[model samples]
Target: MSSALPPASSGQPPVAASPLQPVTAGILTALVGFGSTFAVVLQGLAAVGASPAQAASGLMAVCLAMGVLGLGLSLALRMPISVAWSTPGAALMAATGAVQGGFAAATGAFILAGGLIALAGFWKPLGRMAAAIPPALASAMLAGVLLKLCLSPFTAVAVAPVPALAVIVTFLVVGRFFRLWAVPAAVAVAIGLTLAGPGSAGFDTAALALPKPVFVMPAFTLEAAVGLALPLFLVTMASQNIPGLAVLSAFGFRPAAGPLFRATGLGSMVIAPFGGVTVNLAAITAALAAGPDADPEPARRWIAGVTAGVAYLGLGLLALAAAAGFGASPPLLIQAAAGLALIGAFGASIAGALKEEADRPAALVTFLFTASGLSVAGIGPAFWGLVAGVAVMTLHGRLGRLTHP
Candidate 1:
């Protein structure tokens, strides 16, 4: 025993390892990312008029694109830069409902949005313009867009009390004790209930199949381009990529924004014909890999992103199963799970929006208008929220300067 437990010469205690290893953190990040939002993505696609097959293809395409881009960018920059399908953009698509030319037109809009994102990298002015958006307003708009989804837990409970309540309760309990595992755990409960509860048709594991690409030839129209593409690009940049970059910077990794944007844009373009929406830098999930828990050495944390990418690829292969399960389950169950998953994000966005007192009023206006689900000239509330918020802030600033001067 004495020989086996060699006593330390020094009086100092030995250092303990981190609770989370890089690989474990990576796997957790992937699970949280995909588990939390995949249902919402499916709903969003359906809202925009994607058929079952098309939606399944979109899910697979997005998963693969995000995986490949996440891996490539993380390796290239040697930074834990994770890419994701734009969750906010998907939400916007859902809110916007079916467009003029149907899902094909929506696909065209996706391509245009991706192209604009790529252009932002090449054009300094455009990038600067996106950057110039007031942080408070941007966060407000994001919060507003998420408001409806965040409320779905309650609504789901009303619709299907037993299953939805089970998911909700599980999420709350798990989130309190093990925050990261909340969504995945809730998802597990939902799946369990779906398979075991009365009137349930047991899940057929054998039915799991590899996702196949289904091309939707894009039909671009000015309405789709203006109504869908522009707003999608804006929200994806303002709400997602910018915050994702900020998260990296916070962790002392200064990845080049231009190249990262370009990479995601290119990935989105490649997947667009196959029903993928915009691929972007991940804000929420990026934190999981970029933080100290992933690895003490900043340089080594890129491995976490690579691991997450591999996880995403595996999930992509199983997209057909997920699509089928979600498609067959009660919509309320999916909504409840998604709403619970978004609670943290919703809270963060609201806090961010209201942090500065001077910007509070403008931020509130933005949030209200966006949450109101207003549409003008076929354009959705997100664009209007941005416009209104900026206008209010601008006017307030000008008036204050005049008064003070």
Candidate 2:
């Protein structure tokens, strides 16, 4: 038989040579999204005092939440509306460290943040207010939060030169040829080194079993509400959700904003009891599903979103294995991998923070204060950083008026 397409007999669109283009793109999106950030998610949860089992549960829960929401919304709206866990919020948590009530309080904060997101969707003014936060200050806070983590590669080299060099070299070489796969490549090398290194002695084979969700009854504390919840909500909205919408709009798909936010917010709340943090729109990975690479026709790209959801569910099944793998790795190795994954984000945030000269001074103040790691009366630096920036801006405005008068 000839290896060729059969001619269309009647009125119909030509069947493409390969029907799996969108499916391939969707799978790639899921792979890059999960492999690139799951380490950060685990590190963040662990930093907040979660046990290994709880971190695995959080990973599984977030994967499932994003999968369900992305699939459902894409089907309902007929648009490539991808969803993902809040990577920036997780980075913020990693920097925030443990709060007063520990992981339980962090769980409560997650719920509160989810509630705030849902409320923002329902009450337009709240959403607008969240949007109104100064871009410079917001970017500065994120950059500062990322500063320590982004420095992990050099620190890792100091701690373990051989393994760190291997990981870094892999990242650099692969990134030169395949930018999207760079972190994943480095992550793969780091995992292999962990298996071969002394850290493997503590590895527990039992942790490789299929994961069961671990529920932590939330204990709300004032410290967590201010330091963790508010900042998490702001970062997820400003960095992930808003940018995700803009990506889709750039691609010419304009779905109603309210329902999408509500869906992610509600999904996040539902999963919080099971140790999950925030889930939101996919910012970096959304382009994979929404772009022309997914499909020649924009209308049919929803299939890519659906495929990505299915792919995420499949990856969630491996959460336990992933946790086990990381458990065998040195903490610095994991940190290095997470940091490499975030280098692009850190650079972008720095650029955004300094974009407007008028906001530069306040942005610098915010960045320094946040990176200082100072705490006062139980509140963390992230919360106070915004306050410091605003105070400087106010003072500067008053001084300028006095001089002009």
Backbone collisions counted per model: 0, 0
Candidate 2 per-residue lDDT, tens place, 275-387, comes to: 89899999999999998778877778889999999999988888887887777756678789999999999999999999988778989999999999988888889889989
Off by over 4 Å in 2: 1-17, 398-405
Q: Model-by-model lDDT, in order?
A: 0.83, 0.88
Least well predicted 10-residue stretch by lDDT in candidate 1? 1-10
Considering only N, C-alpha and C atoms within 3 Å, which residue pairs clash in candidate 2? none
Clashing pairs in 1: none
lDDT of 1 by residue, 156-253 (tens): 87778878888988998998999878888897788777767677677767547677899999999887888789889888998888999988888888
| TM-score of every prediction relative to native | 0.90, 0.93
